[model samples]
Target: MSPGDGNDDDLYGGTGQTRTRLPDGGQGDMYGGAARRPARSSSRSLITVVGVVVLLVAAIAFANRGNSSSDDGDAKKPDTSPTAPTGTKAVTSGFAHDKQGAQSAAANYAVQLGSAEMFNKAQRDRILQEVITPSRVTGFEDTLDKAYSPEFNTNVGLNKDGSSPQGYTFVSRTTPIGTKATGYSASTANVAVWCSGLLGMAGENSKNPVTNSWFTISMKLEWTGGDWKIVTHSQKDGPAPVPGDERASSSDEIANAVEGYGGFTYAR
Candidate 1:
């Protein structure tokens, strides 16, 4: 399907709340002036996170599979794990304080929770179930549902039911640039994720053309089950650099680009 947009955020009709571009603390531009740029973790939260990780282990399948046996060669498959240390399960557990697992989890969760799919009820529920502490899932659902109200949906040029506009593709993606731990403990860690995002709608004759943005997502993480889970989260604008004199892409081009390019899975 094709996409539509108007970089100016035409969907909100200028309300500037839908698709969340809510004002965050930072120095960067959204559409005009400003610089462009772009969490803590806890314990009961940890248990819940680890528990959820157990449920998703089979689904993620990132664990390293031992190399296949060879008939003549004896060259063992060198370490193939990406971004994980020795003896630690790949992306399933081992989110200890010193290992930076909490930081990685925060980076990955930022991508999932900030995705366009989070606007949909089913996907949102699943995400909350996986990344948020068990005790908070139901509450987060109710709170977030209210946050993405029907009016907010309409402002983003969607139907009141949160369905995409006909022939249009809405985009909301987040990419983590880096992570830093402000605090750590046996069961809790506080980390920061610097991020950039793409938001708005795509297609011909679209009012809100897709636009790029930068921000920071602050997450209060808890040590649940064993891994890190979000206890609270907040956002702020970017520490953006001055804009260059580059011409912006056409709406059609932007739409095509979004449709053609797939997003990354891991954040770090």
Candidate 2:
């Protein structure tokens, strides 16, 4: 549930933090019911398995042959007409005008603040300058600089200087599940973003493994110079669901997923 003042009443309830509980070892690897070992297979059983595999392979090939002609990507193209404007710029001030736009602004800002870029001084400064209001930039920079101290860096498996550790890829990302405008006006807006996040070091046999978390961040946005700019923000524990018993992917898989998938430029 959202961690607001019961703003989105239909969806929220009492909350500190809620998590979907997965099995101890892994979520994906959990076995339902009894665990049983397969019996030794005879030559005939082996032959049967091979036959099944061949049929499955043939079916997969047939499916792939038809997929190219069936262009799902084209069907999923977003509407870019004026009525439903998809903001072209990653961030442009003086553009967002409604509650939807305010939600979009909060979502994008959440992504930027929780990004891996925020760990680096230069990139963090750029993001602050772009996403935050002018009045808050100096204070935000000072607070963040102190919070991302050398000890904090070491704890998160980064170098003392806030750089990614050599031979290791650091991962930090926040993905908004959905957003709500708790309050809105032409000059001011309050938005809450429900988010799922991941943070940790991704490396083969790394000591610090990646972790997933859920939280809600509420931003008080003000119209300054035109676009929505963050004035203040706060986060609270989530309304998590019970985790499933599924096996967690390997470190290599995690790293590959992080590297291969590009993040979206969020819009309402």
**Top-TM-score candidate index:** 2
Model 1 scores worst on lDDT over the 10 consecutive residues at 52-61
TM-score of 1: 0.66
**Alpha carbon lDDT of residue 28, candidate 1?**
31
Any runs in candidate 1 off by more than 4 Å, and if so which? 1-99
Q: RMSD in angstroms, candidate 2?
A: 16.3
Taking all chains together, each candidate's TM-score versus the true structure is: 0.66, 0.67
Expressed as tens digits, the lDDT of each residue in 44-71 for candidate 2 is 1211111100000000000001112323
- Judge candidate 2 at residue 163 and give its lDDT: 76
Clashes per model (N, Cα, C within 3 A): 40, 15
Least lDDT summed over 10 consecutive residues: which range in candidate 2?
Answer: 54-63
TM-score of 2: 0.67
Top lDDT model: 2
